[model samples]
Structure formats: C-alpha cells, structure tokens
Target: MYICAFMLILGLAFYFGWSAAYSAWTDMGVYAVSIMLICFGAFGTWTYYNIDKENKANAK
Candidate 1:
C-alpha cells in the first residue's frame, strides 16, 4: 500500500517537473528530476521484491 502510494506520488511529481522543464526550456531541473525519478523507481522495485521474498519465506 505504501509502495503504491509512493510510486503514485513520485510519478505525479515527475510529470509536473517534466512539464515545467519542458516549458522553461531548462535541462538542469529536468535532468535532476529524471535522475531522482529513476532512483526512486529502482529503489521501490527493489523494496517490493525484497518484501515479496520475505513474505514467501514466512509463508513457508
């Protein structure tokens, strides 16, 4: 649940940031936000996989 919420928020932020950067014609903000977006996505995916593994172990 938390992970879903986090991903949703992060996705929204990225959308807004991307639009802003596009309109402003600036690379700096877009680059920074994109990096963060990728990092957050990767971290979230890792956490989800770890959680699933733990749950499966406990189930056994």
Candidate 2:
C-alpha cells in the first residue's frame, strides 16, 4: 500500500514535469524537469521492485 502511494506520487510528478516541459519552448526548463522526472521515476520503480522482492522472499 505504501509502495503504491509512493509510485503514484512519483509517477504524477514526472508526468506533470514532462508535460510542462513539452508545453514550453524553453530548453532549460524542459531539461531540468526531464532530469527530475527520470530520477524520481527510477527511484520509485526501484523502491517498488525491492518491496516486491522482499515480500516474495518473506513468503518463501
């Protein structure tokens, strides 16, 4: 449950940032937002994957 919330937040943040980047013509803002989105997305994904692995390990 916690993992899902985190994933959602991170995903939304990334999506909005990317959208803002696309709607604007400035390269700097786009690049910055893109970098942020990538980092957040990667971290969220990693956290979710680790949680799944942990749960499986415990089940076994």
Candidate 3:
C-alpha cells in the first residue's frame, strides 16, 4: 500500500516533469500511458487498503 502510494506520487511527478520538459501534452499516446500509470497506482493503493481492512475485520 505504501509502495503503491509512492508509485502514484512518482507517476504524478513524472507526468508533470514530462510536461515541463517536453511539452508533450499534445501527444495522445504519451498522455494515455502516463495517465494509465497514475490510475493504476491509485487503484492498487485503494484496493490494498480496502482488502487489508476487510481482513482485519474478519480476523475479529
């Protein structure tokens, strides 16, 4: 979960960096890939936290 959050932050930083460095927002392919990374990172983090919570509840 922490790793996923880190990845999400990293992805966001990378996207901003790429935009600043290359001005590639006009490119759809680049946008798609970058957005995908951010989305996946967010989703993974959310899923992990929810599963962990569920497991803890079941344990009791």
TM-score of each: 0.54, 0.54, 0.77
- Worst window of 10 by summed lDDT in candidate 2: 1-10
lDDT of 3 by residue, 1-60 (tens): 887888788878877888788987677766777788789889999999999999999999
lDDT of 2 at 33: 60
Writing each residue's lDDT as its tens digit, candidate 2 over 1-60 gives: 456555556655765666676775456665576566566666777787899999999999
> How many clashing residue pairs, candidate 1?
0
Candidate 1 lands at a TM-score of 0.54
> Would you give me the overall lDDT of model 2?
0.66
Lowest summed lDDT over 10 consecutive residues: which window, candidate 3?
25-34
Q: What local lDDT does model 3 show for residue 40?
A: 84
RMSD of each: 3.6, 4.4, 1.6
Q: Pick the candidate with the highest lDDT.
A: 3
Q: Judge candidate 3 at residue 58 and give its lDDT.
A: 100
